[model samples]
Target: MPRMKVLLISLAFVAIIGSLGAALYFMMKDSGDKPKSSHMARALAFRVGFSILLFVCILVAWKLGYLRPTGIPLQG
Candidate 1:
């Protein structure tokens, strides 16, 4: 795997984890009876977007021949 691809994938994974952590934080910290849904929503949106981005990256890698399936053998 190329360094650039590895770096990008790792960063995307970190971003996704960060977004999830943020969402959990917002959910746990909002207890003042004020509307805190926005924060959580935003965090969730970020997580979803990052997940999609990661998926796209993987697809692109596969299409570009950077990624390939392994560890399975067909018993034809």
Candidate 2:
């Protein structure tokens, strides 16, 4: 369904953003030898916030009948 596609696309976008954020955080941390006491906290907060948002999106999509599971076979 179109709605399913939309949800999938949105999830993919969120994943990409999360990955980029994590990569940036790590790269910055690696390059800097200074103490990063707050770095881990910040990253954790971002991940938790974004994960909650993603969960809410999934719930909404499921409730609206936009995301039904398809038992399709996957190729190795």
How many steric overlaps are in each model, in order? 0, 0
TM-scores, one per candidate: 0.78, 0.51
Best by lDDT: 1
List, residue by residue over 1-76, the lDDT tens digit for candidate 2. 7877887768766775775587567656765554453565566566677777777877897899977877897999
lDDT of each: 0.87, 0.70
Q: Where does model 1 exceed 4 Å of error?
A: 31-35, 72-75
What residue runs in model 2 are displaced by over 4 Å at the alpha carbon? 1-35, 72-76
Clashes of 1: 0
What lDDT, from 0 to 1, does candidate 2 have?
Answer: 0.70
Instruction: Pick out the ten consecutive residues of candidate 2 with the lowest summed lDDT.
Output: 31-40
**Model 1 residue 31 CA deviation in Å:** 4.2
Candidate 1 minimal-lDDT segment of 10 residues: 30-39
